[model samples]
Target: MSSRRRLLTASSCLIVLLAVGGTVVAQMEAGDRGILPIDSTGTLEIDGIHVDVGGKDAASARYAGWRIAQREGFKKLWAKQHGRPESEAPNLSDSVLDGLVSSIVVDRENIGPTRYIADLGILFDRARAGELLGMSGEVRRSAPMLLVPVMISGGTATTVEIKNPWQRAWAQFRTSQSPVDYVRISGMGVDPLLVNAAQTGRPGRGWWRNIIDLYGAADILVAEVSVQRLYPGGPAYARFVGRHGPDGEILGGFDLKAKDSADIPRMMAEGVQRMDELFTRALAAGELVRDPTLITVEPPPPVEDELAAIQPVAQVPLSGIQIQILTRDDAGLNNAVAQLRTIPGMEGVGVRGGDKGWSILFVNFRGNNVTLASAIRARGWTVSDVNGTLRVVPALQIPGAPSGQ
Candidate 1:
């Protein structure tokens, strides 16, 4: 072979290798675009509603099915809330029902020529529904709990590392009805890196604390689902376990079976509901409390600057004195208020009213207005008497100079 031919062959191989590497990188990055959760925050939701209705056409049949679903969903909700039978639920007109219903989620649908058969989720306006149900508008929720859904399939455990049925089940679970305050994260961007299946097994509270702080959650809940398939595209069984905190203590576990691959979604959705029940029971029993070991309360840094500290002074023990603070913005007004509170003899301070331009402050000082004025002046503020009320102006901010010097 010629030297020139050998060089060309080497170059061709290098180009092919680079192209493959680029393709691999692109595929890896594509995994970051996971399914984002649909937020169904304050509404009362009823899921697993079965609707089947026939009409002149598909559209009409779907419409009829939805109307029927609303009626069925309301009955189910009423029965669940009042501990009564569906037959005993109040008969409300379509007009009244329309006012209360928020939205209808079609879980799965089959539209025939003149028939509509579907599983649906109905969301009702909590405030509106509460009136009819004799329930309160306010719902008591648990402290924020970070949900780490772990699914084990084909001998591999994964969480938000990739889009999966287990994660989707939890993301779609309506938390408004449940007392457990679930903090679900979209498995996108860096979430896959931070919250993987391995993170759940870690026994370190320090690492858990960082995760809690990042997600604004007080604790963590590890919901694990292990799938066992009997055959390809055949029956499947899933075992679910609810674990809590950094230690990953098991709260409860359950088993569910799916008829086929298509039924896996429904099974997962049901699993979510069952897991929620387990958590709710555990919470009421005080088993779902956040681990105290995870809490790291940093002591507040001490202030040692002379200006920041209030000088010791004799107390006069008198009533509050009225003062008007002059400022251009809320920051200036807040700074002025903070400074005034540092006065040695100040008992209490309250802002009565005012806009961004100014604020009316009532200062309860142990000393008289005269003494208070002297203390205010010492704190880089201009004080003047306007009738009986004292007027205070914050220290001027000079360019390239320290403020309140």
Candidate 2:
């Protein structure tokens, strides 16, 4: 072959090799770490410290990897496809890198950069892996849009109060921290009356349906229906009840009783507290997955110096005082003495030269007065009542200044 042609061919081969190598490296780097798109039906399991995909035994490693890639890719693609600005889709190379780390840990054949390998082929417990990841099991699910409904039911007074106390209680739920798209309150005032009347074939069945429709379905329901209203005596009381749900199926429930109106708030608070506790427990138990949006981080505001706004000022009393100013800047020293001469007392002021940029002031407090001493100290100035002679100095004066002398 001609030398020219040979050189061209060699260069072409080099280019091809570089391209292929880059593609492989990119693929390898993209593996393992990511927010895997978990199946709504899939269960999560932990074998030791590793989280394994559960639910379907047929889910292969390659399938899992593809799912992760598709999920990560779709997030990018969705933004672009929807004509989102480039800034919105700025390359998420870090997220892809995290996926790579996770893949290495989960992949059985090639345990790449992960700290340890996990066998995910069989049933893996999500709760166990969540503990390892320092994440609640609910956080493992990829759906940012899904809402888990929780129901609250208790005494009518506790649940029916217009204040919606259970709403505050629901706020205490750990999963409640997750984005809740909808909150439905049942057994609250008219809703319960309407619900019970509807159940009894009363005239308000349609009205109850409208009420349900108006409030929508709750991801969590807190019902504080007065199982029994309190009377003057004789053990009258109310009960607080709470329930969690997905598509209206109650995941869990709790109940507590209140003997008085004062006990209502206490019981409500406890009910809400318990609801939160139970929600966290349910997440740990693999019963609920958290919304991904809740994991989103907000950028912090810029920091400002705390002292930037304040200017330092010093004040000293000149009552019957003879002052002396010593400074390298003779003009500044004279100005300071001039200012001191204007004070109420008939004291005279004088400036004298000192080392570096320091100055000294001497004052004779015609009488040994504590008020003058305190007034000088109040201005953030140093005052020394030495033998009834008041010496004033700036608080931040240089170390060798004669103020302390």
Candidate 3:
């Protein structure tokens, strides 16, 4: 073979190899490796066996157990890392940590007459919970009866006894105390009025001091008070007090100002809501608990700019062709220009001057015009024969710009 011919063949082979390599690299770069988009409305299965309490489905009985478990795990991990005694971990009662796991839902699926399995799904955050609840009427209409777990707590027990003889009789006469309710300490020899006064803070510290002195044998004191009025020097006052032991230590006391009665309930409710919010925040910050199943869905892969993939190739006919690209502004025009620069034989790809939006691509076509037009069309762009020139416009560009403008 002639040396000149051999050089030409070698150059052609190199070009082919480069083009093939570039295509493979681009394909690899564009590969997506993220979570597949699952339908928001999908079934969740929780291990039901974990929730058994007193012949009741554990989901209904232990409401925030998963959340508590997560929190406990976090505390345990923190204690290990900080070299703190695990026993010193924050003492969050089951009730206190219940709010963190309220979004967990459980379902029972029957495998046999006496056997079943529980499926669980927990909303990772409030937004996810809300979404699961259905963000719109259409979604809500489709999904209903999202069964969620409830958290219940058994409170700490504190024992108290009435040491006074008279108070003991009074206590014996009253009905039984309810669980989790305060028990009235009775049996102290102190006068009921004096007790009331101490409870109600009428006789004040002097009266309470005297009662404490008298109840030296008692272990805990209880006082109940009610207010009659607010402003300065009103007849409103509370006068119930009960002293517990020989030392007269006040174990529990109630304050009742007329103003407080109306606001206390609201304040209590607000406190409960605040606690719920705190738990939610703690869960979100990964401070209280971590659940491996509560994985956040990875975001979708970015869509490729279809127009930018159109490579400019040389040897394409451009006789009398005028290409004008209308972009939003210079930045957009610059982007378009950058993409155009990659096209072979396409030269002078520059942004238009002034605020008039557009980028211009001047191509010196030397390739087959038909083949070039087909490639542009395949990329969803338009090719037009204008004034005997082949004008190419990206589909993403603004419509209605006059040719050659």
The list of candidate 3 runs beyond 4 A from truth reads 1-321, 344-356, 368-371, 397-405
Could you give candidate 1's per-residue lDDT for residues 1-405 as a string of tens digits?
A: 101011111112242323564553332224553556666665788877888899999989988988898899998999988898999999999888888887777777888999999888777888789778767656678899999999999999998877888987887777878899898877776788788899998898888899889989999999999999999999999999999988889999999999999889889989999999999999999887778888888989997899768787675677789998776678877887888888887888898887646678898898888889999888877788877788777777433432121
* Candidate 3: worst-modelled 10 consecutive residues by lDDT: 142-151
Residue 192 of model 3, lDDT score = 36
Clashing pairs in 1: none
Which stretches of model 2 miss by more than 4 angstroms? 1-161, 164-226, 230-248, 288-405
* Cα lDDT listed for each candidate: 0.81, 0.39, 0.35
RMSD of 3: 34.9
RMSD, every candidate, angstroms: 23.3, 26.5, 34.9
lDDT of 2 by residue, 1-405 (tens): 101011111112243333564553332112221111222122221111223332233335434543443234434333433467435543435433233222212213222332222322122223332332233435342122222122223422322233343443343222322223334332334543433312322223344334434555312332333344446422334343333321233446555776764455445555655555554565567655532222325679777677875676564544554333334476667655664544444255444435545564555443335665665566676766666655567455567765443
Q: Pick the lDDT winner.
A: 1
Question: By descending lDDT, how would the candidates be arranged?
Answer: 1, 2, 3
TM-score, cand. 1: 0.65
Q: Count the backbone clashes (under 3 Å) in each candidate.
A: 0, 52, 43
A best-first ranking of the candidates according to their TM-score comes to 1, 2, 3
Per-prediction TM-score, please? 0.65, 0.24, 0.18
